[model samples]
Target: MPTLLRLHTDRPGHGSGLRLAASGEIDLSNVDDLKSALADAVAEIGSSGEELVVDLAEVEYVDSAAINVLSAYADAIHRIVVHPYLLSTLRVSGVTELVTVDPVQQ
Candidate 1:
């Protein structure tokens, strides 16, 4: 299988908040790309430090590197949108407080 990870940012309300929609697998192979994508978004946010939401609805698998990326950005993020299966991993990883999984959205 091809190792692919996709990340894009959505600025709702014309710059009020950033929604990072990530899909595919996030493992060591694409960790750097993931970080770069996030860094770009943060740079785009400018100095206002607006709220950000990470939408991971299409993500089916993740590795430690991905978790680390999330950890690094936890402070900048308002919440994380994830899938049910990934919830336990985030919880056990002790990041449940910043993550949210909506059944309807999933």
Candidate 2:
């Protein structure tokens, strides 16, 4: 059996940002979970002025379904930092402009 999809979220205090840490694969099998998580994150950020930061460092894979969900929103400024590997995939898919890609320090 495949490992279950897991997403961890952290919403800091006032003036702090929101962090969504995702692990495991996000394919057709578990894209919905990711979508739900993202939706909740968006809702939380929308209510508060806090930004969003998604850490995809442990995400082994992502498919079009996951990509489509992410493409729907225009995140707040300085929000949404995608992992380097995920950033490459997003760039190739032409959705890099939709989210901010933060470079990982070596």
Candidate 3:
């Protein structure tokens, strides 16, 4: 199996937003890790009023289990920017309404 998950966080300054960029595959095997990572990221933001941006530009695959975890965390997250490739998968799986998806750049 590929390494499949990379999480990077950045806090620019006081009241600045936190960016959680995820790369690689998110499947049943690593769905728990993804959930844990998101939980930790949410904790780090800690009601500071800073926005949380989750960038899924590098996620190549997402299984149903991953979607369920993401759906559970959607309300807690500020925004979810999923790559274009995953949008259809999410929609088909009925998870698009649970989270927001930023428009993919051309």
Candidate 4:
């Protein structure tokens, strides 16, 4: 079975900042992909104090398992941008307390 989540990573030319754009549905079945992507991003950023910008504006859904993955990398993540509807879930899951969560501007 294929995972429903898709992750895209981008590194800026000159800083410790990196961006990861995720789309599709995130659930337990495919949570590993999210973890792997974050892990790779962290490795790339190395000891430079990686600050990640997660663009989840196109993400339609995310389950608890996916939230856990994001939390695991909270220290490395600078912010997470998601569709407005997903805000509550991330907040209720305590992700908002760990990192910045913003709604994508129209």
Clashes of each: 0, 0, 0, 0
Question: Over the stretch 1-106, how does candidate 3's per-residue lDDT look in tens digits?
Answer: 6446887788757776887878889888778888888899889878877787777877888888888987888877777778788888888877768777774565
Q: How many backbone clashes does candidate 4 have?
A: 0
The candidate maximizing lDDT is 4
Stretches > 4 Å off in candidate 1: 14-16, 97-106
| Ranked candidates, highest lDDT first | 4, 3, 1, 2
Name every residue pair that clashes in candidate 3. Answer: none
- How much is the lDDT of residue 23 in candidate 4? 94
Q: Over the stretch 18-92, how does candidate 2's per-residue lDDT look in tens digits?
A: 888888888888888878887888888786667777767778788888777677654543444565777778888
Candidate 2 regions with alpha-carbon error over 4 angstroms: 1-3, 12-14, 76-78
In model 4, residue pairs whose N, Cα or C atoms come closer than 3 Å (at least 3 residues apart or on different chains), thus clashing, are none
TM-score, candidate number 2: 0.80
Predictions in order: lDDT: 0.79, 0.73, 0.80, 0.89
Off by over 4 Å in 4: 1-3, 12-16
Q: TM-scores, in order shown?
A: 0.84, 0.80, 0.85, 0.90
Between candidates 2 and 3, which one is better according to TM-score? 3
Residue 60, model 2: lDDT of 74
Residue-by-residue lDDT tens digits, candidate 1, 1-106: 5579888888768756888888999999888888888788777765787877778888889889989888887777778888888888888886766554342262
